[model samples]
Target: MPFTASANDFRVAPATVTEWKAVYGEVETVNIVPARARISGTVVDVRVTEGQEVRKGAVVASIEDEKLALQLRAAGARVAALNSQMTNAQTELTRAQDLLRTGATAQARVDAAKVQLDVLTSQLTAAVADKAVIEQSAREGDVLSPADGRVLTVPVTAGSVIMAGEPVARVASGRYYLRLSLPERHAAEISEGATVVIGGRSNAEQPRQGRIAKVYPEIQNGRVIADVEVSDIGNYFINERTLVSIPVGRRTILAVPPQAIRTVHGIDYVTLKSLQGTLEVAVVTGERVEIDGKEMIEVLTGLSAQDEVVTR
Candidate 1:
């Protein structure tokens, strides 16, 4: 039996196309600073929790300072003792001067008293400085935030033992950007200042345009890494995964309606309609692209503009 074909046909025309490669990556901040404990002690208090926002120089946690308190007391005592000794030396110098004026104390005794007063004055100055240093160390027991951002992780809880210079909390500095990993083959195509489209998946709420900020020199696992800067980031959380697309190059290709393409067995074909007769033509397909909300199948080969294909 002879099967009738649809009279309507689609004319193929070369369309200017830009090829985009979809890459998977995560949302991250450009600056991430770890807040560390300045002194070794048991965690006494935590002012901020995970996901809490903090300002620069804000106190994040406090360490136990019982030992520091004792040291501070000892320092204060030393300073007080120096002050007492200075006062006594000044009194002795005054007595010696009065005796010298009366011809009761020798000139050598007055000179010795003046020297003692001067020495005690210097000792007092040194003691006061030492006390100030101890106070400063005690103040550092309170951990502070390094930057303005949300706390990502707090590894230690209250009552946890911690060491000096160990990171207690990890923070995301709120300068959000995207980190993408692509194949090493794309190294030549991507560079700093290139355009990147983010949130390109079907479920994405809004597509965003980003600029490539950096391209890492080292390639690991056959993949190249790049960082992108984006503007709209209030809706995205740190470390959230998203889809990114980068354009490699532009070319001209034939695009046909979806119904014009047919699958027989494992091969794709299109029905060509011409004055000669109807013929089934084999085609190699590329991406299914959407233009202005209209979907079209890209013809990689076996078709060109000026060819007419049956729609049904």
Candidate 2:
């Protein structure tokens, strides 16, 4: 044993590792739907603004139609009038029945009175139904959210006249994802369930993991689109642009532990072992990485699979 410098020699060999490509992913919603007005009227008030989270059936805006109010008033008056007429007819029918029993009126007179009362009763029922129909129409003036989501667009404002079925707000519902577009050249490398890196190589923090949830079959504009499902992607801002690293391909290269390579004056050198002689050789190094829980660095040049490296 000469000194502590003498250590176990590792044979440097070519190994395949995933090649990553950096791309910007846009945060988007899976479903974009509109909350529409249920009835044609002037928007009286809007309860929500853009980016507000709302639940399904929550009233986003209230609409009012003067015509509907007038109709409701008319219906109320008609119901009132029908009730008065029916009450008078009931009194007349009771009096006529009394007269017929006392032999003071003909049976036909009492029969006619009873028919009049029945007719008034039916008219009163019809009037009440019409009043309820008008009241329902008034309630429909409250524009409701179509689904539980964040409101994206609210084009109409208070006092704006809009028609029935017109959009009051555009909502983004369902789960959010990072929509990535990559060049068509890397299409074959991407597949569902493939691991993805949340941040690119520039980020020093530990990369968050994501999965390829879906890959679109159609290639448009020479680009391949994919939906990545990151567990905490929902925390990202909608439509926010962020960088992600995807496994575009794989490459075979020689790698060795960093302990084997010693740097002097910015030049990297490693101890080489051979049958003829052992010497320190200058080696070109690539990016530093960890493989199998061991610190390793890539040897871009001055290295071969036949070379055995000793810890410096």
Candidate 3:
């Protein structure tokens, strides 16, 4: 019996396609910057956790120095004492000036009183400045993120004592990319600006694409390091593993759409629209491939590029 064919038909042709090799790549950021504590203190509050997204200048954690509070108290006391002394010196200066005007006190005594008032005023200014310094140091305890990114790890916890310049949280800065280490032998083929398919099985129907933004010059451990830039790879994990298909070479082959091929009893068959009529021909199909966002099947044998296969 002749097999009925559908309205749509596919033409088999030898099209040059990229031959891809699958390799594993880990998600990584371009820069890993740490948010450090500007002052030595104990961690008081942590506003962020691992895998949390943060903006630039956002406070990641807060550190509190118990000693800073004590120092501030001492500074306040000194400032208060100097202020009191300055007021008394001003009163004495006024009294000495009045006595000199009445010819009761010597000019030297008035001069000494004026000098005492000036010295006390300067001392009060210096003490106030010292108090401000302590307050500023206490405010520096808040650790802030240097860049916009996701927090990769937090090494400090509440009540943990950390010194100045110690990292409280490490952030993965900027968009995520897939870092791949390919075999050294394929180093010659891999180049910057090349296209790569990302995150799909061995014959994915609709695979996402990525570009090789950078290629490392030196090979490490018999592998060439490369970075692939995918626009929306996400920042869910820092070292998440995934597979990528990179083009290593190119090949020419006769391909037909999957709609043109029908499988029966494990043997793949395709309907051919010949001059006589629609004929069913046994075709040995290879891997199911994705070409230009369309699903296709590789015709290994029993078919030629000139044949017109009917879609069924």
Candidate 4:
């Protein structure tokens, strides 16, 4: 006896079972804002060059202000003078009390001497405070770094005269982040501590991992903004306006070639052919995964590991 030839007679490739899920994401990039100087004067010294990493509070540049230095010196001299006068007054007061105890000075004289000592003491304190203010101003002449970062721009060279509050150098901090602009609809899905995949260029393999550190409260221009800090990205210093791709979420599901599945009567079906026969099996489809521009549909049901499906 010979068996009749049917659709099942044609051998079909076995469907490779795979789990997949819909992945929603957006393109992300690294953004940076340079820091500026708070005060300025003539650039006396440039401590850091371009691309030099600096620690927080490190002196990046120094400004020379002759007038400020002179003021500081004068204030220090005044303080020293006041301190000497205060010491003399204290000695005199001690002597006056001793003389009063020995009945060689009137009590009124001793009281007057005490009042003079107090006045001198107050003057000394005031002078010391004034000197501190002057010294602080002098220290401000040297521009210090606000945070740990690399010098991105040195707008002024040594001996360049700069006005007060003028920027001498621009610095990009060592800390880096991926700034993502997501659609307003997806804003609610993202929050601080969310996992993300960060990579340079969309097609790059082996992306670095990151986590959401901050999420903006309000939407701008129909987009919600967030920042992801790339953990363990190494010493690579990303500059402003560098484009990168970030994967916000991922999952797994059953997938098959889109061509292998067909729809009829508002139902998804795949032609399952086995050695026994060919049968139409209804299946619930899930998210589609695109690999090399070919689409694969996720299978939910009506298929088993032992069955084979033909892509027609």
Candidate 5:
């Protein structure tokens, strides 16, 4: 006679199973901007440092302006001198006209004074315009941030001379994303907007869901690169690495609670409970996964949807 035992039986049923492709990736900023020098001069001031957050149009560095300041002063002086000369020329013209009306000066002398005043006036106008051009050049000496972001590097210091267009600091933009390189063989499986699971193994917090944001058409080093966007990514550091899962497609299969299947002598088995009795049956298993927050084992073979498996 067989021994009797009380057990709970689970009815096997076909459930939707998603086929996921697991890959490794890194947390990265959406954009990196190189804050560079707009003018060639010695760095007079360093206003920002690494890891500092800055807003758009914020001053990051200042180039030496003593030379520019002197040039501006000289230009102003030249304009002032020209204005004084114009004043003297106008006075001479007025005096010449007064004398000609009184018949004390020749008409030709008044005409000469008028020409001299007109030349002086033209010279003053040109001098003022030249000064404005120098003033604009002085304004461009201040280096500014292109966007709001965190500074990654400040390569120059006070008194360091740098050339125009040289990078003064490197910045990582505010938006964050995950960058993954998938195997080339899985190229056909991935698509934009595919569901993704992020940081399941390393992150202590509950794993977050993300979606495939982009897929590059170009393949390199036998892999295809892609980007994923996730929510609540503020806590993650830039360039930090994490595990990611992307589901390519789905299929219907027999799934059961993990407790229902047990391994004996290196072989997987499930006990089938029927009206007659309990019977031990050999089975093959695949990946263990969670469905709707419940852990389930994939029954690849040796199990059917019509069977009732006993689980203690």
Candidate 6:
């Protein structure tokens, strides 16, 4: 006959457990901008130093071209001279017309004077137009920033000569992002807007929240690449080629050893070992979680904390 047991016959221990699921994610990228010179000239001044913050369209430096300056001055003088000539031509043309009407001057002389006045007026207009072009070139002498960003490099000195379309400084714009790669199998599970956890060497416990922004179209080296956007990280100034980990999703359920659970009468059940005796408790099972290379079924119900269950 089976031995009889009392409530004190069996010992029980409380187990605090939580359910979790495994997921996969990938790393994303941030881009750095390199500012280039739009016009050619000597560097006049460097206003902002390296690592300094700058605003959009701010003048980072000035370029001086003596030739351009002389051209502008000559254009201005030519315009003034043409304007005086145009005034004198207009007055002479008016007097010639008055003399022709009074029969003091011949019509042919009047016609010639009118033609001369018209030619001088056209020259004056052309000179004024040329002066406007020179003034515009003078404005381009100052090197203005293309966008708001921090200065990364100022390659030219005040006297250094730079060619047109050459790069003057490099700037990194916008918030930094981490670029990472994930296995192709895991990439399919991640979608845009999915939340993830980022892990690094320094802050292991303190995880940063990130979201899936994009996934690459093609697979490379049996892996799919993606970009994750981190929020509220605040200008951490991450450099290129930084490694990071991302969490995709979470799972929660009651876990039990696979052997401890048995299928009977088409229902899942667990044998509970209480001090009084052994009682068979019916339960609902969820997705299996692998712990220490052992399979454990999630316990849905019919089990409480501190309950002793048989494990084979």
For each candidate, give its TM-score against the true structure.
Answer: 0.77, 0.90, 0.84, 0.55, 0.84, 0.68
lDDT tens digits by residue: candidate 1, 1-312: 012223578677777767789887788887889999998888989988888999999999998767888988998998899888888998999999999999998999999999998988898888889889888888898999999999999999999999999998988885888889998988888889988888744564678799999999999999998999887755467878888889877777777878888999988999998788898999998888865467888888999767878987
Global lDDT of each model?
0.85, 0.86, 0.87, 0.67, 0.85, 0.68
**Model 1 misplaced stretches (Cα beyond 4 Å):** 1-12, 200-204, 256-304, 307-312
Local accuracy of candidate 2 as per-residue lDDT tens digits, 1-312: 111223578776667778989899999988999988888999999999988999999999999999999999999999999889988898898999899889999999988998998898899899899899989999999988889999999999998999999999999999888999999999998999999988733456567889999999999899999999988764566898888889888888788887888899999999888877788899999997656666678889988886777875
lDDT comparing candidate 4 with the true structure: 0.67
Residue by residue across 153-181, what tens digits does model 5's lDDT show?
A: 89999999888899988888868899999
Off by over 4 Å in 2: 1-8, 200-206, 275-277
Query: For each candidate, C-alpha RMSD in Å?
Result: 6.2, 3.6, 4.5, 9.4, 4.9, 9.8
The digit string of per-residue lDDT tens for model 4 on 1-312 reads: 011224433222233332221233343333233444555567888888887877777887888778877878888888888888878888888898999899998899778878988998888888888888877777787777776766777788888887777776666764566677777877666679866655544465466667778999989999888876776655554433434444444444445677778899899988867667777889998767653355666677776544567667
Most TM-score-accurate candidate: 2
Mind giving the per-residue lDDT tens digits that candidate 3 earns over 27-69? 8888999999999989999999988989999999999999999
Better candidate number, 1 or 3, judged by lDDT: 3
- For model 5, the local distance difference test gives 0.85
Q: Could you tell me which residue pairs clash in candidate 4?
A: 19-253, 20-252, 20-253
Residue 218 in model 2: shift from native, Å? 1.4
Number of residue pairs clashing in candidate 5, backbone atoms closer than 3 angstroms, sequence gap of 3 or more or interchain: 0
TM-score of 3: 0.84
Clashing pairs in 6: 7-275, 27-180, 28-178, 28-179, 28-227, 197-247, 254-299
